[model samples]
Target: MVGVAVLAAALLLRYAALEAGVFPLDCAGAAADGIGGLCAAKWLLVQSFLHQRLGWLSFVLGLAAFATRRRGLAWAGWGSGIAGLVLYSFDPAAIGALLSLLVLARAASQRRRGEEQPGEEPRDGLGVGGLG
Candidate 1:
């Protein structure tokens, strides 16, 4: 999923930009100090990844999945939640991941039971043009 890939990139970037210091963290002074090659942009992203921003984002995705019952939302919420825990945003991320799992499980069960999506017509030769 795109969310998973984004988090993975963030993890790698954190390793490079923050842990390895491949680029200076103090990029607000980039222009003044003549730093080049997107250092300021990298710094801005790294800052957002700190301070539980990802945790809140995962939680919101979980809430959206619960409200909409969409597998895409659930997958994003779950993956981002696990990534958030690793990225230093634990509690909310854990809860959000659990929520996403529950939604996925329910969806899987509905699929097994031949349930139709809300507002969707059944195509088993019972409606519309009699799809046999």
Candidate 2:
């Protein structure tokens, strides 16, 4: 629920930025000019490229994590989200990351509750046979 909302928000922001042409500008005279328009424009270009590349990567990784129930991959998605946040703090990437983290946390909680799939042992080493 919350995760879905976050992802939806993130997607909206990402697409909006793409549609707004707010990325990739020259930095020269950006400081002297109001709003650092040139710098922002340059950074937007860089961010746009990164967004394109990392966005797809994160999506693929996140989808794989969800489909395969791999918590680590989900965490990787979270990391990617963080990177996206760093690039554009108010973007959909951040929402995507938050959603990924939420999903990972939910899966972890489910595992803690003994609801894990068959043959899928918990990684925390709580029930090992040789321990005291």
Candidate 3:
């Protein structure tokens, strides 16, 4: 449930950021430079790659992770999400997406381990004391 919501948010943010060109222009620089801002060009060339390309990639992965329950898929999603988040700090959508993927991965791992040793009981805090 939460994962789905996070994934959705990430997708939305990525689309909005791309469509708005939110990364190219530094707000402070733009304000100082006015309409024909050199800062915009500088920022665009420097930041557009990650904001436009990698951002979309991350969003796609997040969406896929939300739709699927596989551990490997979740890890991929999380990795992309983290990369996107690190690159784009203005939006926290990627962070949420990453969290969802992490949760899914943990659940999947636990489930797999449980299945591998179905008959065995889980170990408690106490150490083994029996001597052969």
Best by TM-score: 1
Where is model 3 poorest over a 10-residue stretch in terms of lDDT? 120-129
Which lDDT values do the candidates have, in the order given?
0.77, 0.61, 0.54
Worst 10 residues of 1 by lDDT: 122-131
Which has the better TM-score: candidate 1, or candidate 2? 1
Compose the digit string of candidate 1's lDDT tens values, residues 1-132: 555686777678667656776775555663567656677666556565677888888898998998898899999898888777767789888788888878999888778877765876556425557535
Residue 72 error, candidate 3, Å: 2.2
Candidate 1 Cα misplacement greater than 4 A, ranges: 1-10, 30-36, 116-132
Clashing pairs in 1: none
Model 2 misplacement above 4 A: 1-51, 89-92, 116-132
lDDT of 3 by residue, 94-124 (tens): 6435754665866767777565445644442
- Quote each prediction's TM-score: 0.63, 0.44, 0.38
Query: Model 1 RMSD to the real structure?
Result: 8.2
Q: Rank the candidates by TM-score, best first.
A: 1, 2, 3
Candidate 3, TM-score vs. the true structure? 0.38
lDDT of 2 by residue, 36-115 (tens): 55456556546654645555556666677767777888877776665555445335555556667777988878878867
Best by lDDT: 1
